[model samples]
Each structure stands twice: as C-alpha cells, then as structure tokens.
Target: INHQTWYIKAEWRGIDLVPRMLELFEGHHEYPVTEKVRIDVLRRFGYYSTESNGHLSEYVAWYRKRPEEIARWIDTGSWINGETGGYLRVCTEGRNWFETEFPQWLAEAPKSFAASERSGEHGSYIIEGLETGRIYRGHFNVINGSTITNLPPDAVVEVPGYVDRNGLNIPRVGDLPLGCAAVCNQSISVQRLAVHAAVTGDDRLLRQAFLMDPLVGAVCTPPEIWQMVDEMLVAGEAWLPQYADAIAAAKARLAQGKAIPTRTGYAGAARLHTKTIDEMRADRVNSQRNAEATDKAKLRPAAAKKAG
Candidate 1:
C-alpha cells in the first residue's frame, strides 16, 4: 500500500515526503487509501510507508500523538487496519489457547499424520525451484550491498531476485526514490540498535533504541522514555534476565519517588480494550476473520480517483 501510495503521491507531491505531504491534512477529500497512517507518513517524509497501519504506526513518530488525535486513527473496522497491540494480543491468546486446549483436543484428533498442501508461503517453493532448476522470481529481504545505492550496505532491503540451480541471485535495481531510501534508513537504524542491544545486553543501547523509535520519541521526552524503559524492565523481569542490574537501578529510582512526568491513563493512539470471549462470540465470524487474517482488508477498489 505504501509503495504504491508513495509512487502515486510522490509523482506529484514533491521529492521530500516531509513538509510537502502536510498539504494533505488541511482539507477533506475522498482519498482512496484505506490506511491513513501511510498518507501521514508521505506527508511527513515525502515517501511511502509499509506494513499494516496498526504495526507500522508504532515504528514512526507521527500519527500516534495526543489522546484526541489518537481517537481519529483508531478504527474498529478490523484489527490490522489499526488496532493497538493487535498482533501481540492475537498471538498471545492463540498460544495460551493451544497450551490449555490442544492436548485435550488431541485425544479426539486423527490418528494418522497426513501431509497438508502448502498454503501461500513460498519457502518450500523456493527450495523446490533451487533443487529442480526451475526459475522463480520473488521479493526477498537481503543484506543491502549495492541493490539500493542510497541505503546502508548492511541494511536488509526488500527487492526482487531470481532463484534456480545457481541459487538466489540479486539483480541490480539501482536506487529507490530519495525519499523512500531516507524512510527505510530510519528503520534500519532502529533495527541495528535492537539487534546490538539483544546481543550485548547493553542497557544504555537498549535505552537508545527506545529513543530512536518513531512513536516513542514523538510522544515522550527523554526522562519519560527512561522511566518507561524502567517500568517495562520491572514489569517484564521474568523474561528479561539480561536487564537485572538495569531493573534494579530502575526500582531504586522509583523508590526515591522522583519519577518523570507521563501522560497518565494514556493507552496510546489506537489502543482497544481487549474483548472478552463473550464479546468476541457476539460477532464470531467477523471477529474470527479479523483475528486470523493476514490481510485485514480484502476489498477491491472499484476505481480510485481524486475526489472533486
């Protein structure tokens, strides 16, 4: 959506997606895109954005602002359209249900282990093409060398590639639009910071990574971000053994009663209260569809024209 949105928008919006895209906000129009965040991104950075708006909005500094503005972005049409913490809530519930009920269900399950056909995933198809010497073209996330001249060499870039007996080969695609590369570069910085923080257990680096996050930085001051990290570490202590010392320090700080100011009761821009099982069952079909779907929306636009 962002790629196509950027191509069309950038063709006319100017090379930089930042200030130029802002022109879109002042007026009301029947814009064609379903994800509003992408439009906000183009207006801010002069490039297209990616991922569903729900997850994608978390990675940027805009859109998820004050509580009032947040209400505008929150849509209950479906989870992926822009539900807060949608992926985490869904996956966690799935795992919990599996652990609690799968064993019981297994007692009545089929005795034979029958192979099921592959669905839409391409991992097996790629392997088959390599072994059988059949040609395959697919978009891949690979370490960027020169495929995109503007981005960092180490950044993972998604681009077109070919597969066969010779193994995967990347074709030189030259450069993305200047604005596109800039937007991607920002994400690469965050990715690198996260990877390094995990490998080294560097609390300082972890804190830096939070500061680099688009939404985190946009909505928080340095002190608030620091306090938030401490809060998260203490809350997640069971899973964060590496942050033992950091958590201890955070606890000490809180104990001193000198905590930074924060937006009390702020759930975030598009957060939703978790639905109970009874609430979920009320609209079972649609709820199940939204929860399980990879793509939240499956609508085909009849025609996308600039509204007069």
Candidate 2:
C-alpha cells in the first residue's frame, strides 16, 4: 500500500517465505538462471528492510523501548538486536490509511477500471502437474499452522507452502526466532480471547482482549479501554446476539454519567480526504492510473514526489 515502495512488492516472498523456499527447492538448480537468481535473492535477503508485513515496525517500537519486558517475553537473546528485530517490527498498524485513502480509491472506481486492481493476496493454484503426471514445483500460500512449532496448532496461520500434483504441503517452520514468535503470540492471544468472548458472551474476556492489544495498551489507559470496549459492544449490539447481556450492562454503565475525557473531533495523526468525483475529473489520467494500478498509492502526490 505504501506507494513510494511499490518496487519492494517484487520481494513479496518475505522473510519466512524465503527460508522455506530455500529448503524446498534445495537441489533442483537446473536452469542457467539459477546463479544470477541466487545472487539476487541473497542480496535482497541481506540488504532489504525485510519485514513479513507492512507497518510492523510501529508495533514493535513498544517492545524495543522496553528491553526488560521484551527479554522476558521472548526468553532468547538471539533475535533481540536491530537486524532480526526488523522482522518483529513487521506487525501491522495504519487503519487510518484505509479509512482515508480507500474512499478516494472507491470514488475513482466509477471512472476507471479500478476493479482490476483489487486482487489482493489471491493467487493461482492450478498447476500443469495435475494433468501431466510429471512433477512441477511451485510455491503456494495456505491457511494452516505453517509457522513456528510453538504456536497453537489450531490457530490459523498464513504461510508459503509447496504445491504440485499431490496437494499443498505445509512444512513445519520449526520456531520463528523466539522474539518473532513472542510478538505473533501476543496478537494470537488477543484473537483467541476475542473469539472465546464472542462465542461465550464473556464481556470480561472481551475487555481483556482490548487491554491485551499492543496498540490499544500503548495508547489507552485501563479506564479508557474499558469505556471504549463498552461503547463498541453497545454500538455493535445488533450483530452481536451473544453480547445482549453485556450491551444492557454497558448501557447502565453509560447512564451513570461520569465518562473519561477523550479527544473529541480528533482527526487521526495521518488523515487524508477522499477526493470528490468532480475533484478527480480535474486529473483524469492520474485518477485512471490510480484506479487501475494494483499499487494504488503509486499515483498519490507524496508517492509521485518520492518516485521522482
């Protein structure tokens, strides 16, 4: 989504993926392309600001600031430094990007072939090996426990898999460097808590999930977390049949009148307005390009400046 860095998308076989690929296709160096490809691959693995996902750096800033807590969490010093921690920093943030930029993209859709740009993470799987009875190797993404062995088996994981005639094969990725697993485990804990809370109507667990979130915990106090959770549950009451009792309780709490101070009318730290259709019509070429390009941000003003 970061427009200035669209070239980096070519490196989508991320940190976890490259290692698995190196293992899967170990001895099959048949093509004249292998030498140059290997050099380029190693160069990227060595030099690029490799992260599993976007904006993870923002999330890990919390752990980096508190060394003792990070040490306790990961229990290993091997991956605590700047280099390996880069992977941990690959968590996620930036909801404001979606809120602000997405409407602009959607508005452009009516005037351009924007529909072609929405193929996010969807991949082709049907291989020639299925018809021919010969083995053709390729990588695939599957939903499974394909990450570190220590993570819960039932937890849904997105990882690269080996695909061919038989099926998608998810390999055991042993353990992510301890620190990396620690960061993933934190989010997993929140997800599990949220799921259990929704299924069982346990408001307490839901509150805890909010408290457990790295971004939420870093920004909001306990009182603010509690109030926010209550407000959300109440607002979403219609869809949350299991939360009926909790929503009623939340209304009673809100009725008590004393509310924590909050920043009213706060535009987020990085907010951009969605352009109106008429505004887009002023620059039809760029608007059409933004709508059709998979890297939507590539045509944004800041991105254009950076690209130049």
**Candidate 2: lDDT of 45?**
42
Regions of model 2 farther than 4 Å from truth: 1-54, 57-122, 126-147, 289-308
Residue-level lDDT of model 1, residues 4-77, one tens digit each, is 22332333445554444446543435322445775566565665555655556666666676656764554545
Task: List per-candidate RMSD values in Å.
Answer: 6.5, 12.0
Alpha-carbon shift of residue 168 in model 2 (angstroms): 0.4
TM for candidate 1 is: 0.75
**Candidate 1 pairs with clashing backbones:** 16-46, 17-45, 17-46, 18-44, 18-45, 18-46, 21-43, 60-214, 60-215, 61-214
In candidate 2 the C-alpha lDDT for residue 264 amounts to 96
Q: What is the C-alpha lDDT of each candidate?
A: 0.66, 0.51
Candidate 2 residue lDDT tens string, 1-308: 11001111233535454444444434444311222223233333422222212133234324333433432222111111222332222111123233445767677746433656544433333444555445544434344353447667766665545655675566666665444456667877888999999889999999998888886787678999999988998899889999899999999999899878777976433223445555666766655554444543321111111243
Task: Supply candidate 2's per-residue lDDT for 249.
Answer: 90
Using lDDT as the measure, which candidate wins? 1
